[model samples]
Target: MTPRSVPHPRGVRLVEGGADVAVYTESAEAVEFCRFDSDGNEHRTRLDQRTGHTFHGFVPDVEVGTRYGLRVHGPWDPANGLRFNPNKLLLDPYATAVEGGYDWGQPVFGHDMNNPDQLDESDSAGSVPRCVVTDRHSFDWGDDRPPRTPLAETIVYETHVKGFTQRFPGIDESLRGTYAGLAQPAAIEYLTDLGVTAVELLPVHQFVQDSHLGEKGLRNYWGYNSIGFLAPHNEYAAGGDGGQQVDEFKALVKALHAAGLEVILDVVYNHTAEGNHMGPTLALKGIDNASYYRLVPDDRAHYFDTTGTGNSLNVGHPAALTLIMDSLRYWVTEMHVDGFRFDLATTLTRQGGDADVHSAFLDLVAQDPTLAPIKMIAEPWDTAGYQVGGFPAEWSEWNGKFRDDVRDFWRSADSVLGTVSQRILGSPDVYEPTRRSPLCSVNFITAHDGFTLADLTSYDQKHNEANGEDNNDGESDNRSSNNGAEGPTDDPEINDRRNRQRRNFLATLLLSAGVPMILGGDEMGRTQGGNNNAYCQDDEISWFDWDAADQGLQEFTRMLIRLRRREPALRPEWYRRGPRDRSTPDRVQILRSDAKGFDPPDWNNPTARTITFVFHHDDADSFALLLNAAENGVEFTVPKAPGQEWRLELSSDDAQRVEGKVTTLILEGRSFTLLRSVTRKDVRGWARAHGYEVSSKGKVPRQVQQAFDDAHR
Candidate 1:
């Protein structure tokens, strides 16, 4: 029987007695499906059917563990952006599971290294990984349900699968550094105990290990360089990679969900592993260069790379958009992922050469039914431009301003008090004009790209020499301080200061009004030895040293997380400001250390190092936050509340309490304190007299508090 044509779903789908395969490539003159036997012998069959740009065919006896690849025959004119060689076997763009690693040399390059314009005609089948036809529905997801945690209450813990489990002693030896490792009871318990709602994992997409990093005896620990968007990275699977990687990843998601944790993937849809004109042809570049990538208008030979990864996906093209959308849907629907944090998302919105809010990519995502309900977050910037608040209203962004301003305030940078205040209140200046809520800002002090929390307080400068770039790579001007001594100092004073700074950052992040994303291992004081960019260091430098974890810091973080969860006022859904009228209970208020409302001059004061925030929520306890980032301790006069007394709750410095009717509180240098408002027993009598039901010995009801405010008003 002749192979029948089918073209609805893009990748290989198992049918009765056979399998149907399809690939989308508009420029390919011919497409051949090559299946490899156990002995590595290739059997080539040309796909004779075409529907629009999709080439498809059905092959008999194509079983579930079948290893296969594609060879697209096309024009080799490089100047006009056509560099496809039939000799180069490409992995399917919609591959669900890829089964090998790249050899990474001249054999894998589509064009000749010596002559860029000429095709190499070298067979890359031996060098590049082949796509495996997986039984996607085999996983037993018994009673699995997504946590679907509200974005406002989300506490994202950004972690790498390998790095998080590689050094964890809680799991077995074989399961370490694998998907199964993360699903173990110990891992789940740790996350649940820490109070994070979601685990925003670093890229699990099938990524190519960098050829250069390989030459230098290092691996891409971050896994940002994606080649197969749909497939889970095979190396991360404790099970074998033929088809087990898919099931292993699904199991991970199931386990996380069972533990009431959401899984948010850090996806790299901006670009593929293929670098540039001189880059390897492992996948998209070899399949169809012009259709998948954004090539320069004048010079088609080169790419218009905004991602700084040598190539950007052509979001303007339907094929590229379809692939991305398909990948996203597959992850959410098949893999059961809760959400996605798009890396360099701004590049995907550049449909017309500049990032547009209503770009095709964003519009597609907005209308996609499968993706609409899932949480979508954007890194919101690219190498070419910074678009922090540039994403559409439906999306939250990795607030770069929040990181910078918070760092500046803690490090005592001049004239940042106003900006830091804006950040702490959920960056209303950035998101309010767009009519977005406070949840639009995902507040974080340190991320995977920069210094870990421990290093942020211990290193004034980036020490990235171990990355082999001679300290030239990674960001400079980190707005970081070394306290008194740099890296691994024995000075108790300096160590104490660093520890205090970490607490301050954690407190500020959790207590602020927005989604909080803690860098993984930050609670336990993980460090990369000042290597701000540890993407390539997969060994001891990147893994969490559980034995050396700072247990004190971990407990402090847990306290902050618990406080954040217990108080709804800290994570508001909308932008809140001081009350417009006296009758309105103030949702938020900024004040001087003397308990006076901050004037315009005080906001702009360059030397201002101390500030106070008064927070009131209808459904939770009220709080007063005192922050002093100065070199000397400051005496803060607590704001007076008639029926409530200020009780010390949490402090970064030595704990101290105020006795009856005492309004003064002393905050140490570069420290923060959180005070809870305790209602006086007489307030219950006042509530009862006002005809409101009152509880005699517990916290006051919100209605009672509101009634008391109206009475005062």
Candidate 2:
């Protein structure tokens, strides 16, 4: 846990206890200490150059506002994640902030051979950019109360900082598309209105556009490739000196907190901006390639490449672990971030460069009280290894299975026998174990890397021609059915079906017991235009179009979220039976569509497409949610209770208002609805869901039909 800073030989010439901070250059041809002030003027930092290009020193006057850059003395090594050119300045990964967006040129490019094995060809770093010091943080938040909303009650809204605020008319146009923009009154109003408790911003860490992307006149829009864990991306800041980015980000966090919203950052620790072994080397590679990266143990030149991002962070190293831990703590204590959702988090669970599910990082997080209170979410998988349900207890994980099941269920026209019930009820099969609460599964259908919810139901295949990469990069197996069309359509039949499917999926997402994550702009029906891998487009293709807002979809989304909050049954934290369990033969009943006297309906019966859940809760009885995904509605009889008369509650058929405590007759085909009663009553504790027997090896028991039939009265 102690931070260990490795010494660079002849690096920084410590002048009387290192004035504030110092930079050491051991291997640049010529060293230059160009210092800039907050006003971008020529600020001076004294330099002491050791013979052989070691320009190491400190600026006596270099305090928080001191902005300085160092020119190093090494030939650029382009392929090994090191781009050390004595002439070109490099951004400090540890710098607190940065200002101004990057416009690529010879000054920013490395001159070493594109292949590291090849000799140097040109001087590429004469004018490369530099990061600066910052002291812009200002807040009087003493004993600031974090929202303290439990994981069970947290509904995360995964969004892009710029995209969320870019189109809002209320955010000042100048502040639009910046970190401060997210804290705008208009944006806060919208998020609060939607009942979102947390906002998970796509990676805010400083990053560089991929070289290939730059070659193609593209920019890294999503910000996944990180260069700075401690510093905020300069592009995201409205305006600042090189060091105020982090403070500005904290200001945004504070503003969000004021709105009762928690900010969970999307962190990418799996890899750096450095791509595979062939990437330009900056700090890690230059400092110690063998130490900072997870190199192939036996084959030093090669790497495991678990994350597609090339050079995976050598998380097994104590120094690397310390860096990550320190960064996380700083965000929590300094920035006041509510949580982190690690991208490609599985890579962190490897020790000694091998992917071990219960590695040291995972162990530390599981036991670290300081880090545990905040939300610890993992994407749960990477390209090389996907350990779904792999991390230790207390860590909520993104359930990819939840996404797939929900998508297939709504999009599946043919018989997907047991998908609807499984997904609608918190995906118990995936998260219910070892007392792991239902909220453990972060249920999300569409995320930043995919088509939006609207597009998922509209585009069966991706349309990524604009990427200019031959459309071969993104995923092809999208479990989407476009209602018999490729993209856009005018046919009312298919369009209506797509709209209804959207509503159903949204409702199911909010009502399900798991923690729901609404992909940003999904409520407004945002679309990637079928481009799933839009990492390289910082244009309109990746930006959320505010002019194209779907008011109806947004309102539909609002009602679904409101209903989820209103009904406690919809958000049960745990399904384990409790003392006040509502189970009674007189008041509660689970009847199969064609069964008599509470007998299990013939589940294998494809024709029997509808199952009526007849039950009651406090406030009223006679509540039923009839599900019929088939073409024709079937008349299923509900055995009359001796003293209880059935009154109409709500049905999916009534597109207007189909909720509350009331009774109803048969539900319609290809639809699901909920009904309620005027009088309070007890409901069935156990549902007619596919029951599981305790199978060996901690796996869910197969959905046995006989066990269900035995529950019949």
Candidate 3:
């Protein structure tokens, strides 16, 4: 039958009697759509229709669940970046469902192993995975709506799908470590109870496991090496991955939204699983290598890799941009995801080997109506450069400075007072010049990349020897401290210090003015046994241990989250300067331990370890936060309020003591204390009527307290 011309839709779409298949390639001389039967028989048909650069055709009897692959025949010139071998069977770039894994041998590579310039004629049909045709709009999204939590109120929980539920006690053993496991009632209830507004899952895009790690008997647990952009990782689906993984992922999103939780995906679009020149011809490389990847201007044989990955996507080209945009829209419209957090996002903005604010990729995302309202977050850096506040005003960023400053402050590093204050105030110094609100900073102390919260407070050095990199795979300057002991210790003082430090970090993160993201297992004291980089260890080192959870720390984290949710003054929508006058009511005051406003010189003082923040909101109760990072306890003079007395709400130190109507309190070293202002009119009136001689501006004496209690009794 003569193939019909269909160039609009890029992927295979279900029609009445058949399927419409389209693949975009600018350099291919001929493209063939190949299908495999249940018995592994190959039937090939040429995509004879071509409009501009897109090659498309219609298959008469193609149905959903059909396994298919693409084969592009073109020039094999390597020096000018045209690598096309018809021997390789490539997965569809827009495949919604991918089946099987790579065999990871010489057959998968397009070039000869010994000679780089020569093409290998070995067929890769048995080595690479096949794309499964799926009905994109077949999932029943009954009355499902995205939570769309506002940026200011968002509390992000960065978690791994398999690691989060692999050992969860509430879910079934079969469903554990799958997409179905996270959608279960147990996982949903736990998140709702913890009060986080969104769950920022790590990469779920279909990826390739590294062959090197396979040789070491390890797996790529992080899921960063993506091969299929529109498909969910087959290993994460509980159901078989012929096409059921699509519906299962959609159900997971629906279940999360029903529970008032937003699902934010940590997407990887900067690079693909295919490495440099020596890498496999998985999908795009076999389709159109010159158009899809950024190659060196003079040396087209080499790739311009800014992502630390072997090759970066050529976002400047129209072909690559279209693929990325299509994949993003498919996730939002078809898959029902709420937002995205781009990994190594800076690499996407490099149009000419330098990060540009006006790049075509950012421009496309800014003006696209479907993506305008979606919460777009950028990792904001790559292996090349760090662009913390470099994105547009409409986007938020993972604030690396916030993490470093908060860690340094808690560790009592000198000259960090100024930066820590800036971090606590939503990083105005970073975002203010860009005219962006405080919500633009996604403040997080720990994430999937670095040390877990428990490990951060227990080890000063990274224990990444398990990563098979000779203890050099992770970051050396972790900004972490072991307090007193290196590993587990019997010393009660050291353990107590470590526990207090954990609370300190959590309190700082939740109470700070920005969008806070808590590492998933951090609340329950999940330790990696000092392994800061456990990307390869998918077992106990990375999984959450429910049996050994720290219930006390969990309760403390819950309390902090509840407090953050309850207090409006804790999270401001925008950066606010001090009130014009005292009566303005909505303001923030940074005061020293002596209850005096900080001067320019005081902020520069390296010895200044004690600081206080007084947050005054117009509609909520005023709050005062006291932080002491000194080696010894410091007595803080409470700021005088005319008709209000400070009531102790929460403290990181369990042994902290506070009496009624406190005029002065000694905060323990490396501890945080929160106090709310309570009106003392009733008590003061009672004291005055009983002739207790209570002063209007000073502390109410113990005699008056006793008399008031006695009279009330």
lDDT of 2 by residue, 409-447 (tens): 655444444554555556656656554667778999889
- Supply the global lDDT for candidate 1: 0.89
What C-alpha root-mean-square deviation, in Å, does candidate 1 show against the real structure?
4.2
Q: How do all models score by TM-score?
A: 0.95, 0.81, 0.94
In order, how many clashes per candidate? 0, 31, 0
Q: Give the candidate number with the greatest lDDT.
A: 3
Query: Model 1: which residue pairs collide?
Result: none
Give the 10-residue window scoring lowest on summed lDDT in candidate 3.
577-586
User: What is candidate 1's lDDT per residue for 307-366, written digit by digit as tens?
Assistant: 888999999999899999999999999999999999999999999898899999999999
lDDT of each: 0.89, 0.65, 0.90
- Residue 546 displacement in candidate 2 (angstroms): 2.7
Candidate 2 stretches greater than 4 Å from native: 1-59, 69-88, 100-111, 118-127, 413-415, 576-591, 594-624, 631-669, 678-713
Candidate 3, 1-713: lDDT as tens digits: 54465898898977767778889999899999999989989999888789999998887667989999999999999899999999999999999999999998889999998888899999999998899999877789999998888998899999999999999999999999999999999999999998999999999999999999999888999999999999999998999999999999999999999999999999999999998998888999989998999999999998989988799999999999999999999999998898999999999999888999899999999999999889999999999999999999999999999999999999888988899999999998999887887899999999998889988988888888888889978888559978998888999999999999999999999999989999999999999999987889989999999999999999998988988887788888877643134445546888899999888999889888999998866645678899999878999998875335576778989987666678788999899898877445556777888776777766767677566555543
